[model samples]
Target: MDFVDLEPEIPDSIQVSRDIVYKETDQRSLKLDIYKDEFLVEPAPVIIFIHGGSWTTGGKEDYLIYCLAYAQKGYVTASLSYRFSQEAIFPAAVEDIICGIRWIKAHASEYGIDSSKVALVGGSAGGHLAMLAAYTADESYFASGCDENAVSTAVQAIVNIYGPSDLTTDFAVAQGATPKFMGATYDVNPDIYKVASPITYITPDDPPTLTLHGTIDKIVPITQSDFLDKALITNDVIHEYHRLKGWSHTMDASVPVNEYAQKVMTRFFNEWLNGDD
Candidate 1:
């Protein structure tokens, strides 16, 4: 990931801490940008956001505005960064995400975040990482040098935006993105692909999920979310699926659709993360 080329204008009412190092290894250091309403009381619910750039591009800077929007809504939100495919392969991004959550928990008191009420929000490739990270919320997956037992990486809920839930599916294998991230095609690394897929970890005890997908997404088909929705139902895991008809992969093309999706996401996060539900 690279530095955010531009930053969003932050309102005075929101408190922000940019580029805080979450993990530092011999190779590189991972950072995150945090936003929270200054007036928010202690034990505030937190949201960790992951950006989408096909798992190869994008960084915390890309999602500043999105994070701030959630902060303004009274949640402590962090825009997190992870290793790209060029730097490392599968499970590396996953480990970084888990580390980010643990870092947040380790410093929960200073940040005034309610560690137990955290939520994961990501779009595109970030969405995939968010789902996989939340599902693999165990100590064994912690990154090297990070304390696995410092705090649970488990999230109370997840908001996945057009992420591929199953990499073994025809659409995912044909898309080439999953293969690139996994370091090989499914035929050669079926086990890795299965371990990387979030759909494979769905269980009755999994956190509630909210998925939004554009019907005409060329990169990641809406069927990905459809399959996840079905699995969630089969496991009796509470969830909501929003299918944006006539829309494509990126939400920028349709203003109304983007705004509506944001509204839905905001409501879902507020209800689940803020303990309103």
Candidate 2:
């Protein structure tokens, strides 16, 4: 059997996916795959995991394992895809994500997902968007031709896995990353790069965040998490930072999170999402 041909025939207790409650572009309607233990009973908190590939190279299906992992832990997990850089830039991907959240809120009762207790989890580029969805409370960021209030774009907790928080760095290493996805900075697109960086929007009202990073990450530096950690701390926002010593950017894959890291992450979500889990 080929991996691509393999369909996860999840049990009836779990729901696989459903329709587009809302959309960004008519041609590019967003989708959501719901995995829940039940649909008729108590509503559960939903975890939306956005995958990372430098904002230009990945899709929702790439995160199937992550979606299942969280669903098994008793949450309605939806892995989502957004418009990539080449197709559309900054706010398009973010708008699609906001639409997905609004869909959950609009169909909250039917899907058995709590609209209030949502968490956005992402790695790298996805992490950047997750943080934006959590903190950018502005109403004008997205196109309002459709239902204006549909996208809440707010999250209760944040998990940034090696996400880049800074776009302007004196260090020659990370300065090039923003250009690859954002085009030329010195060109007429300065505002584009500004919004892509999450560090620009940190505020006191932002939700609590948990960041995991590695010391040797070549793609995104450890200092990226450090800056976010310091800002969150300075602003009195609740945050927890974990540094995977001797690990690289893909530490979650290359290095063991160890017993301690797992305990901390699990506990953070458990306590934050579940009142007493």
Candidate 3:
């Protein structure tokens, strides 16, 4: 499915820069769309958005509205495109996200973003990348092919919308995308599955995370978020999990459930990214 070229309902104060190339690999170029409200103070907090297509499809174009929504709320938002599993598997997508964060920080001054106050927000496959990227900042396992820099890739907060947290579970095994993305099954490559799971990297030093999951989600079960929540609590990391009752994966804004999720996500970002708690 193609994403509509629909612009978000943004105020005149907001300005958007489209199709900015953030990284160049030997295989492909990674790009991102940046949005910022000029009315906000200089050096605004940044929000990095990762698009979800189960690691094989989707692009930054699909998330322009989401980027603008956060930009309208006084942030410099970037919706990034990464290498898909079809082109490169396992750590390739994660490495691309890391490089995107580095590119954002390296160009922070030019983009009016504060390098220290960045957050990540994603849904589904993108959510998995966001959480893994944020949690594995100190690990070198998935850092391959990423930019070599002293600049930290750790995000201040994360807003995950029904992302898969554990890759070794039955839920992941049931999904064809998982094996394709990992290039092997849990039994065949147990270490790869464990390393890719965000639940393996959680620590107290990790940033506050907010997860919103639909109880009736069919693609990624609610148990995925439950696994992440348990790890966050065990490590004493600040986090919140909101279980959307009688809801499914596709959450259009016209739906009350999505509206509520937007409110919660906004508040969560305000608390952690904007220091408004």
Candidate 4:
């Protein structure tokens, strides 16, 4: 599908607020864009999207379609921008996301957001960060500079699309972006790679997870999601995996593939974010 095919005609009923600063750091102001129904009377569940760019590029605008679609579906959606690997190292992006979540929850009333029914969604590197932030909500390592007790970072659901689960894996170790993001080679700091891996924090108590990956993906590889699936299963966590066949990384860029993902994600979010367990 062409890129134009992915652009939907956003209805007037849906409102968009762009470049809302969620955090202010010495380096820059982290921002996010929010989408919601203008006439929403009741508080709605929130879905935050993180964009993929090997942890070095991309922005909140990358998931505009997702935010609009979910907003029209009676949910408040946000796409956040975090510090890239080029500007900051490993935990910086993670920390920024946690801060973004906390900011969203803190200002939930302004946006008619149901703070308790929040979820995180991301693709590729974004997915990895989403998983890390969601799974380690209670861990202080990532919440270092923020007031950890002020607002909770815990989310109800997680959606990982072609995201790498274990950075310590051979594939991840060999990736140039992986080491760059970590600020060290796997040989120099294996522990950092392990700590940054989303699989490391998986537990039965973690939020329900949904993962989608193309079997033919050469970038992140299908094995990343496979490893995540296995770990989630072993932990008895509620999880779903969609291994799309004959597709490559960023397969969602295709209209049909994106639509399929939207369908699956809508169902997953509705079930887990609506008190359905």
Instruction: Please report, in order, the local distance difference test score of every candidate based on alpha carbons.
Output: 0.82, 0.71, 0.85, 0.90
Q: Which stretches of model 4 miss by more than 4 angstroms?
A: 2-9, 147-149, 275-277
> On residues 1-277, what C-alpha lDDT tens digit does candidate 4 reach at each position?
5543445777889988889988888789889999998998899999999999999998888888888888988999999999998899988999999988998999899999999999999999999999999989967766546543478888999999999999998989999999899999999989999999999999899999999999999999999999999999999999999999998999988878888999999889879888221
Give each model a TM-score: 0.92, 0.85, 0.93, 0.96
Give a tens-digit lDDT track for model 1, residues 152-271: 788899999898899888778876567778899888878877778899888898988999898999888888999999999999999999998877786632557656866888788777
Better of 3 and 4 by TM-score: 4
Best-matching candidate per TM-score: 4
Residue-level lDDT tens digits of model 2 in 26-105: 44766667777654367778888888888787777765655655676678788777777677655677777776676677
Count of clashing pairs, candidate 3:
0
Q: Candidate 3, clashing residue pairs?
A: none
* Backbone-clash count (model 4): 0
RMSD values, in order shown: 3.6, 3.9, 2.8, 1.9
lDDT of 3 at 201: 90
Candidate 3 residue runs with Cα over 4 Å from true position: 1-11, 252-254, 275-277
The per-residue C-alpha lDDT of model 2 at residue 256 equals 42
Ranked by TM-score, the better of candidates 1 and 3 is 3
